[model samples]
Target: MNWQPAKKQNDYVQTRNKNFSPPTVNQVLQNAQKMIGPISESPRLDAQVLLAKIMKNSRTWLVAHPKSRLGAQEDVQYRRLVARRAHGEPLPYILGTWEFFGRRFQINPSVLIPRAETEHLVEEALGLLRNNRSVLKVLEVGTGSGCIAVSLLLEMRSLGVVATDISLQALRTAAQNIVNHAIGDRIDLVQTDLFSGIRGQFDLVCANLPYIPRKVLNNLQVGRWEPRLALDGGEDGFIYLRRFIAEVAKVLAPGGSVVLEIGEGQDEEVRSMIRLGFPRAPVRISKDLAGYNRVVVFET
Candidate 1:
């Protein structure tokens, strides 16, 4: 009995466990890069940005903290975000915010991500409003994420906006952004189809409505995750464009400006619509940095 008990105790003697090596920032990023590199245009940068967002640190900090190990939960969350990005979900939707006109606005799949090209429209509107003090009120049809409205108000303090969206969820998103920028009182939100429930006339009407054609959308990723109600523009990509043009005259003020962000090669048709809607108004076409015919300004 003594020999058997002593042998069992020695066989079951405790052994120290080896130290666990958690995933370092560098290892995590490299793995993410391999997953995202195949799909994303800027895989490395995107990986860094997503990780930075998850870690609540800047991308620059990620560069410096390459050896730093992520906690178990952070690694899981970061990997999830990378998977979404790998699936071709827009970066802004994954990150929940995007820079438009030098300001970060709350964004999601409910609205179209504010395009850098759209900023050309904002800059054009700001430039037009700079000299004139008479343009006090604005109307943004299909306000989406309220990027255009919020940006306009932030840059020009004298303006008030009536942002209308057909989608209530979109209105909620826009409203959050309005509150985020503390411009609730300066802006009024209405859930109505183009100019349906809107009563007052706006001095400036900025509409970045759905201009992408339905036929071409199947091949593009713009509407894959974004709401089709916001991106599908019917047969010629001008269905809503036509409707907005037909009815916009009722809400536009005299000498009012309508600044539109048009898709590539739609400038001609947009000019035609503006000319048909407001015959007396002159249409000014401004190209983006890439030299695409982007922003169209029409004065009524």
Candidate 2:
């Protein structure tokens, strides 16, 4: 995506020194701080990640060799990435990859950048699978970037996954990730809304669907950079979520379970919807690292 800075700032220009000598790693980091410090929560770390990308090295390497010099092209690339971050573009999208569940996956504007909180949803799903040895099939709705599905297949060798998304662009991005991790044979990528074209029952159904309300999407700085199709959950922020729960009974196998990542302040309401769909199932909510209610699990 083309991410122009929301407001023009000297951060991009100020980082460029007009001298003949190459800029040292420390100097570049300082300049990046000057450009993005005000806008980023982790300015130094962002600077390091960008620089590391340019240098084809790790952040730890950059730290150890603070006096190393950047090539002319490297300096230019670093400044450009800093400008994008200052403008509110997510770092993962700028870098073209993000880490989730301890593994890295390709990412782009077409897909939502995987967040650490979503890892909790993966953890909950893994917990359920660990308890039930017979569970073999899994389905991930709104499988943007295929982070959840790919991670699950990697963790559980015997399981097969059928991941679905309404957007073809999203399906393409997820397809790249499935191929990248060499798990394409085990995961099927389908372009369909929720469970519309899905055929068989799944032992587990998981999703990190759009849950941000339309109105709320406007005010969010980070949200503006992400694809609306991946964030808009309708007026009440549960439109897509409600639909998923309603259709769970059709695809979920006997003794199967459903796990979903939800917005904050939405635990009880989502649990209620899951209960309405599966009246006799056990519905439970799980919290993220910050202790906020973030995942809802439905087990029959």
* Residues 144-182, model 2: lDDT tens digits: 999999999999998999999999998999999988899
Instruction: State how far residue 217 of model 1 sits from its true place (Å).
Output: 0.5
lDDT of 2: 0.87
How big is the RMSD of model 1?
8.7
Best by TM-score: 2
**Model 2: number of clashes?**
0
lDDT of each: 0.84, 0.87
Q: Tens digits of per-residue lDDT for model 1 on 70-106? A: 8756765776788788778878899999998888889
Q: Which 10 consecutive residues of model 1 have the lowest summed lDDT?
A: 1-10
